[model samples]
Target: MLDKAELGKRIKKVRESKHLTLKNIEAAAGISATHISEIERGKTSPTLGALMKISKALGKDPAHFIEEVELNDVSLVTLEDRIVEKLGSAGTMENLTTSIPGGKLQARFIRLSPGKTLDEHPHTHYGNEAALVLSGKILFTVDGEKYETSQGDAVYYNGLEEHSYENISKKDDATMLWVSTERGVS
Candidate 1:
């Protein structure tokens, strides 16, 4: 069974954290102020679609509303615990090794295969991030500034820069560790 009251509290907390008012959320979600109030006060439950709208209004993932993390019971993760999902050759992605999302933070071990190049995507966020190359070499262009990194080298930036990386060596794959926050403009 769903805990409507708890969910309401979570919703209100997220909204307040983002410094949003009901009027602003209503404008973005097309939901009524009264309805939003009822949901926040635990007087009513929103349908999945309504919840989605509220999450979108807060610039959060819809899944956040239903996520009830019991961190106390979360055990330290081993290699076997990592949930790996291939984003395919489209975008290089690896499983987040941590058992928890680190809340607003994201940590991952990503690999860029040889001869692979990624498209430029701009980032906007509350803070910045750094990337450390573990093995091989990669050419990076951040905010149009070209850079290169070899094993044991690291790159730090605002991450708000439009950036991309390409494996420069055809013989060796590039391995990197990425740490960034999830609260960012995509």
Candidate 2:
């Protein structure tokens, strides 16, 4: 179940991402700015019709704001619970943590076959990232500097810098545990 306040926050986040102001939503949704503000503050709940109107105004589905999320004070995720995604042809990424409400941290395990690379184009995001090489070797590049790390080694860097990685081993697959924080709200 999703809490009303959480739902309101989701709405606010989506609206902000679209650069929509309360007045803009008011004009598009035919809802007053004051009422929208109240709904966003969780001071009052909007009816399904009003929610649909607001969703349409924001170019989103109403379900986006009302999707059910299971909440648990404690979450246990085993290897079997990991969600794996194939990257390109020779890499796999496994999400290691279940979604946590209001959580900012993410953990993943990445694997690259020998002679392959998780070649991310140089990009930056608002957060910090750390990776621990669990097996084989990696050529970790950050902001034009290259650092090689083997099993049992770790590297940490500000994610705002452009970065990428490559599996440098000739016969061994590279495996690493990657963790990062989510971007902070401005």
TM-score of each: 0.56, 0.62
Residue pairs whose backbone atoms clash in candidate 1: none
Candidate 2's C-alpha runs over 4 A off are 1-70, 183-186
Candidate 2: the clashing residue pairs are none
| Per-residue lDDT over 1-186 for candidate 1, one digit per residue giving the tens place of the 0 to 100 score | 348898898889889988999999999999998999999999999999999899889877766677676222134656777766554562356656343423555677777777777553534555566789898898878788888999988887776677777888887778888777654565
Q: Write model 2 residue lDDT over 1-186, tens digit each, in one string.
A: 467787788779889989999999999999999999988988888988999999899877676677686344345789877788999866899988765544567888999988786865767788998999999999988999999999999999998888888998888899999998985422
Error of 1 at 98 (Å): 4.5
Q: Evaluate model 2: give its TM-score.
A: 0.62
